[model samples]
Target: MEQAEIGLIGLGVMGSNLALNIAEKGNKIAVFNRTQEATKKFYAEAGALQSQIIPCETLEEFVAAIRPPRPIIIMIKAGDPVDQQMELLKPYLSAGDIMIDAGNANFRDTMRRFDSLKDSPLTFIGMGVSGGEEGARHGPSIMVGGTEESWKRVEKVLTSISAKFNGDPCVAWLGNDGAGHFVKTIHNGIEYADMQMIAEIYGILRDGLKLSAPEISKVFGNWNTGRLNSYLIEITEKVLAAADPITGQPMVDVILDAAGQKGTGKWSVIEAQNLGVAATGIEAAVAGRILSSQKAERVEAEKILGLPDTLAFPAVDGVAFLKDLESALLAAKIGAYAQGFAVMAAASKEYGWHLPMPTIAKIWRAGCIIRSQFLDEITSAFTKDPDVANLIVTPAFAALVKETDGALRRVVSTAALAGLPVPALASALSYFDSYRRSRGTANLIQAQRDFFGAHGFDRVDGVDKHHGPWGSGAAIY
Candidate 1:
């Protein structure tokens, strides 16, 4: 069999797009799918391209089709299928060959796969591919986890197919063992939170202002020009403006409000809780979806509550509302990042993977779905001080928070009075307040801790005394 420079398995939407992308970048590729027809169709579509690409009849044929010291990218579904694909490719792969799992596999599974393949000469990589099918076809943000040697082998291919973020390659050797998927898991979690926040904004506009979709689209478009500018906001404008084909009405009304998450969001929340980090925004977003799914309860709410028909905003005070909304959104966004970075920090300590938080933020600035202007500030913060505990503590962010706090509080209070749920915004403010006033709740928590764990409480005046461990102690003022 003729040897190809690169091999790609699972010719699905993402796989096919990536394979084509590699081919376009002047690399010879051998492509395979479970179904022969899919592979043939892809090759046929490749047609008269300058870059050589061959379709393989089976997994065995595909493996044989690649050269010695081969590099194969697996784009199969996560979980059992990843293992099955690895098994199928193992026989045909030789020593020094490298295999990359480019799916959303659980980080634990990646760790297991890495351990299982450690003794063998073949190398394994868990890669995180972001930017959806289109990004895969062109250039996507790539996060890779493997040994430095394995990364060196396929680094060229990865760099060639990755997008540029802030003048750096979006692709990076994330860290050793499962870091790639771990980061991707968090990425998806952030995506879930971002989408939900935007949905909440849409609800506020629809239910509170009773604005038409086009009007809402205009508001979002204006938002995209400011600090709130982000991929989610950009898409929100499009979603609002899009007209329904059948009814000639805004499609936003026809779309389902109940968002469906694909588990990563849940995983992030669980992981955050385990690490004892406050992931209020992500958790609230996930909870918002659950609440949205209660369609019957919501219908009953509309009937029983008899929601106001019209919401009034001062005609001359448009800027005030926009500013207030922006402040609220910014506060919420900061809380979300705080939660995500806290997870990264804890995970870094646990896994011994020193992930560059700034680089992660920079990579998300473009190509990825959650790209935002705020990332520039995050990247700057990390550049200035890599070990900064939280983005909220950064001087610039702190100043911004101070300036926005009054407006954010007003907006949240108004939303609450109007019977609108702004959980993400409210949670963000709560996190901010909690962090800023840590001393306020520390006493109560210490009392509870002493009650349970018999942990000695330190006096606010810097006096410390040891009580019998796990023994009941009187509260010390």
Candidate 2:
């Protein structure tokens, strides 16, 4: 029997689709699943395509069926399952075999796995595949972190199966070991912040402006035609317009208000804190999700304490106000991306990835949850200046902030006066404003810290740190 070019484990929704995608790319694929039934079902369903799929009932058979110096792709759940698969497949494989993980595992764990295989002849690759189930069967943006030799063995397959932006493949080798997954994590962090800002604007439309679901849906559809044209915005329009088949009510309205997370967003925020990066927009998004999860507590609190009264939403023409909301959302979106890229820059330095920011932006232009025209603009910015410390300082981006800053400030004010939560949007503006400041109020904070804990502060023109003395009767106070 001829050896299959590659092998894949797991036949779950994503895994199955990816296998088909690979086979369709004309490479013979050997496949196996822990459950024999899944293998049988997939083999039967493949029908006309079965000639390209080699089904194996055991790991030994799967390994033997693949070509020598085998490249195996694993798409199981992101935790212990990965380790278990590695152990199960190790004994059957020889030196120089490559193992590719396409799941959303934490980058730290990926690095640990990479280190564990350092002494062995085997190679490990932790890759990030974004875009949902449909994307897997067609094209998705691919981020690869692995050795040059390992990447060379499979680059053609990945590039062939990944999405293209203006005919350029969205798959690229970022660096060795956890760089791909690290970039993907921050991508999700920006996603969370982007989603929260959109939700805040939706809240302004739903309650403050008293617009109906369909009306709001139309507004979203309009936004998709301009700079905010993105997958999330396009979906928001559909979600708002959808009707429940049973109750005939708006689907979004009937759905639960609580948001559920799978931990990637939290991981991003934790890493930001660890690295001392000011990713305030991502931080607020993570916090907003946590707050949303406390549905019962929110209900009780609203009943216990009366809602505060504030100034009503402006009684301006709908078109004029929606334009402001658009500008507000655009500015916040820019801030979120700026902060996300800053985090990635820090990670690149700390990890020695030397990741190319322009390539990252190019890949994100399509086949990702956050795909947008703004990413194209970002690509242009990076192409012009690859080493910008912060995006707001770039010529193109600085001008953008100057144009939309007022709109953002206005929307934040309206949300505040209307007694609504706008954590992500507010955080974006505050972060931007804070970044532009030359002198801040931290001197007072430093003085207070010194007074209470004897912590030292640095003088602007002096070389040594300075300490402050407590005022008279400080103990009594």
Candidate 3:
């Protein structure tokens, strides 16, 4: 048999689908699973593609089945399992071979892994694959980070299997070491903010406006044809329209309110803070999930204290209010994405990756969960002004912010008065209000900090005095 062009380990959902995709694209692939039964099961299910797939039960067989200068992708649980798997496979790999980690890993871990293999001939690539299960079986947005030579070796195969937008492949060699993973983390962070803002608008429609699930579904379906046109909105329409067979209730109504997370959102916020970038929208989304998880506590608290005394929603023109909700969602989404990109920009500088902002935006136009027409606009903005201090300040985005901010302001204010929890949307509104202002209330904060802790503050005037004389028992500085 001819040696396979590529090899994959792990027979999990993502791994199996990705392997089938590679084989379907006419690239002969060797696949291995830690368990022999899994490898056998996957090959049996391959059907016509079985001829193109070589199933191996051992690491050595897997490695040997691939051609020289092999590129092996390890798709498995992240953290220590990844480290252990790499250590086990290192002895089998020859010089010039590449090991690619395609899991949702922390960039710090990715950087460490790349450094660990730096002295050896076996190079490492931290790759980020998005678009989920369907994407893995078809094509996903792929972000590659490694040596330029290593990227070249695998670029052809990767490009062939990546999603395309307007004939452009949704894949690129982002930078070295952890750049790909870092970008993916920010992608997910933006996703969290997007989802939360959508849910908030849903809450307003369902609880505030007293709309039925089907009615709300129509609203989302309509929005999917407009500026908010995206996968999430399209799915929200379908999900809301779905009915539970057992309970005969709306599918969403029958489901639990709590949402689960796997730490990426939190990591995005942490890294943003570390980089001194304000990611308040992502922060609010993570907090929303945390608060939702405390269902029992919320129930008990509601029983004890009861709902807020204010009206759920003050009477308003239903037609006009619906439009406001739509515009508000768009405005808030802009803030979230701007913050996400800002985080990536800061990371690119800190890590010296020089990550291509325009390319990142271009690829995300398809395949990824956050894929939207809006990202294409982002690509244009970055392509024009790659070094713009903030995405919000760009000419195109500035006009959008001006156009939609009023709606966001109204919706957020209405939600507040109605005692509705719209934390993510509210955060976006505040972020915009703070960002656009020439001066802010932080001057008082600076004085307070200097008074309490003697932290120096910069003078707006030419005066060199850094501290104020607190007219009390405090010493003057």
Models 1 onward score TM values of 0.92, 0.97, 0.98
Cα deviation in Å at residue 59, candidate 2? Answer: 0.4
Best by TM-score: 3
Error of 3 at 258 (Å): 0.7
List ranges where model 3 is wrong by over 4 Å: 475-477
TM-score of 3: 0.98
Choose the strongest candidate by lDDT: 3
lDDT (0-100) at residue 200 of candidate 2?
95
All-Cα superposition RMSD per candidate: 3.2, 1.7, 1.2
By summed lDDT, the worst window of 10 consecutive residues in model 1 runs over: 468-477
lDDT (Cα, tens digit) per residue for candidate 2, span 360-426: 9999988888999888889999999999998889999999999989989988988898898899999
User: What lDDT does the true structure give each of the candidates?
Assistant: 0.82, 0.91, 0.93
lDDT of 1 by residue, 168-286 (tens): 87888878889888888888888877777777777777776777999999999999999899878988899889999998989988877666767888888988898888888889988
- Candidate 3 lDDT (Cα, 0 to 1): 0.93
What does candidate 3's lDDT look like per residue over 1-477, in tens digits?
Answer: 899999999889999999998999999999999999999999999999999999998899899999989999999998999999999999899999999999999999999999988898889999999999999999999999899999999998999999999999999999999999999999999999999999999999988898999999999999999999998998999999999999899999989999999988999999999999999999999999999999999999999998888855898899898899999999999999999999999999999999999999998988899998799899999999999988899999999989999999999999989888999999999999999789999999998888877887999996988988786844435
Model 2 lDDT on a 0 to 1 scale: 0.91
Clashes of 2: 0
